[model samples]
Target: MSVQQMPEATVPGKEYLTFRIADEEYGIDILKVREIRRYETPTRIARTPVFIKGVVNLRGTIVPIVDLRMKLHLHDDPHYGEFTVVIILNLLDRVVGVVVDSVSDVLKLQQDEISSVPELECAIDHESIEGLGSVAGRMLILLDIEKLMSSVDMGLVPADA
Candidate 1:
């Protein structure tokens, strides 16, 4: 089905795919997720940002992998373990994968559960942060995955896309 025609979750609330980078938990719109695969070594490219882990061949498609931990500067030394997973995302007709420490369960959060991102001076792109979501006393950094992946530095998609 076309992206616009994809079926919504049967439940009323919007769903997010929660994942961890370091101590912090983050979430992205569940609809943007294409698939999750076990972490593998991607072929390195020359002269790319350190955060770009490189590209992997996925069923005839070459997908660039970005390590979110490095991308967000969450961990200075990355430890790739069994739990590491690549969250393949479909953004603006482009497919890309992001490496996260681990994948948590999907959460269906109502509008009231989300709150505005607090004012903070940090290295992270503030605009890419959609909001903060609170659930079961746990805080989740909600991300505008489309905007993050389409960013100019990401070079995954045209900035105008």
Candidate 2:
């Protein structure tokens, strides 16, 4: 319903790192993501959302992994094992990791080619998603990283958490 969700308003043909949270395809700005890391056993934290696996040490920085499925209001328990993947993203100049069902691939969508989200009664927090971008009949949900971190109350660390 906001101006941000208008597909034609998004920058087009720009490459985005696409991934899946459940069956839905989602993507973040490729430049905002640092790298794709495999799920490693992380240090468990107390009093956090179950979807939050824990913290991981990337080089010397401590980053938290957010279960994208849970964040998206989907069933966090995955039906297929192949969907487990952790995507490291740089948000609001802060770096963090997100756990997703699967990493599909990178895609390019141009401005004016994207589609705005239709009015729905669903409970998804649209502030984190910019719009839906598609290519070759395949669609991707654009993500807003700055909104994601704040929504979970996770603050970016200077060098470590």
Candidate 3:
């Protein structure tokens, strides 16, 4: 779907899986999430981008793991302890995993709670952001996972893979 067709803050009462990376919280559409797994050291790949942590064998299916902190340039050393989790997402028929410091909880945000991301040239890639969500005095950076993962720059998946 085109960015224009992408889900914006206009949608009402949408569920999002909230997770933490460094001090910020990010949310992804709950529908796209398959499952959450404990953090495990994945088999590292050679000559891949730094953000692409590597691949994990999940029930015979090899899933690529992306470190959200690295991908978003959070510049924090990822602590792979008990709290770290890998969010498995099924985007565009492809299964991938994203590592986050910890998952908070699934939140159902109302339309009024979300606001369109401000138009600004910032360090974070605007194209990957769905919007800014406010709840309980905290702001959540809602992400368009499909757009972010499939973008050419991420290199999480090969062009033909």
Candidate 4:
């Protein structure tokens, strides 16, 4: 029902979208993703950070877009093609949008291929990075949606009036 290339994952019945964030490859659980939309004309807010590119209409609900590239000061490779997609993620109890260069295919990483993040960095690395995973010789970083979705930086709240 969606036209998004998620991480290349095929672990038994589990899968994830492995994508490149700058030079790093990261993956998020395919189930958490609501939908991926192509680049839309975002309405610029009068005053806001560059990463926060305002909101867009998804069906009829408004969803915010956060530029993952700008947030990490990562380079955008035009080779990946234009019209970057906005990944709708369901984090915590809210739905947030993440701007990605391009949606990569679903990855199939075995359980053994996944590596947990170092405990030493757990105390200092608060960048929403969950852990690292390896697939077919390539390393894919897993995203901790729980940490990323409820991040104070995004300031997302319940969508109830």
Best by lDDT: 1
- lDDT score at residue 69, model 2, on the 0-100 scale: 75
Which consecutive 10 residues in model 4 have the weakest lDDT in total? Answer: 72-81
- lDDT (10s digit) by residue, model 2, range 7-117: 556443777888877668877888887898777767989987776768998999998887767666688564436557678887766667888767888877787657787
Candidate 4 residues lying further than 4 Å off, grouped into runs, are 1-13, 75-83, 119-127, 158-161
* Model 4: lDDT to the true structure: 0.70
Selected candidate, larger TM-score, 3 vs 4: 3
User: How do the residues 1-161 of candidate 1 rate in per-residue lDDT, one tens digit apiece?
Assistant: 65667776665778999999889999999999999999999999998888999999999999999999988888867999999999999988889999999999999998889999878997678899989999999999999998887788887765676
Computed on alpha carbons, the lDDT of every model, listed in order, comes to 0.91, 0.74, 0.89, 0.70
Model 3: worst 10 consecutive residues (lDDT sum)? 2-11
Cα lDDT, model 1, residue 68: 93
Range of the 10 consecutive residues with the lowest summed lDDT in candidate 2: 152-161
Steric clashes per prediction: 0, 6, 0, 16
* Decoy 2 TM-score against native: 0.79
**Number of backbone clashes in candidate 1:** 0
Comparison by TM-score, 2 against 3, better one? 3
TM-score: which is higher, 2 or 4? 2
